[model samples]
Target: MSRLYGDPIEVWTRDGEPSQFVWRDRLYLVRRVLDHWVVAREWWKVREGDPGERQFWRVEASPGREAGSYELRFDTASGGWLLMRAWD
Candidate 1:
């Protein structure tokens, strides 16, 4: 278990894949890999074209630190997942 922004967060993996996590009444995927792990928050952002903003984390499980991830921007206006790169 870890705490972020004063919120209690619990993380567990199954077969190295980010299987379960909870934050602010929301469920997240924390995928774990041989080289790294990932955390994703599918949130709605904007109202029209973009869904708005999302939170993502690329974790380096080997080194035990965040490897940097990205915020997914959904164009609610466009009604689709932005085809942008993870780091873009």
Candidate 2:
């Protein structure tokens, strides 16, 4: 399990459009929202998926400007972004 110690964020997105979210000290540009679904099992995955899980908002981002629909995942361990999914 990963330790989640930081400010949570609220995300706002639209269909087929980029997303926008803000954490505590920085703002994030959502590359894309991927494979959002509800998960009601495996408490372990709850770290990434939680109890009564309703969705997985996957995304991708960098330290600079972003474009198009891309996939980005936030690592709860390092507080960084990783590319998980994307569109061509």
- Using TM-score, give the best candidate's number: 2
Per-model CA lDDT versus the true structure: 0.36, 0.46
Relative to the unseen true structure, what is the C-alpha lDDT of residue 70 in candidate 2, on a scale of 0 to 100? 41
Deviation from native of the Cα of residue 12 in model 1, angstroms: 2.4
What candidate 2 gets wrong by more than 4 Å, as runs, is: 1-6, 16-18, 41-52, 63-88
CA lDDT for candidate 1? 0.36
Candidate 2 lDDT score at position 51:
41
Which tens-of-lDDT digit does each residue in 13-77 have in candidate 2?
Answer: 57733377654555667654555543354565556532433344545543266443444344433
Reference-based lDDT, residue 57, model 2 = 50
Residues 17-49, candidate 1: write the lDDT tens digits: 344454446554533432332233355533554
- Residue pairs with clashing backbones, model 2: 46-49, 59-71, 59-72, 60-71, 60-72
**lDDT value, residue 15 of candidate 2:** 72
TM-score of every candidate relative to the true structure: 0.28, 0.42
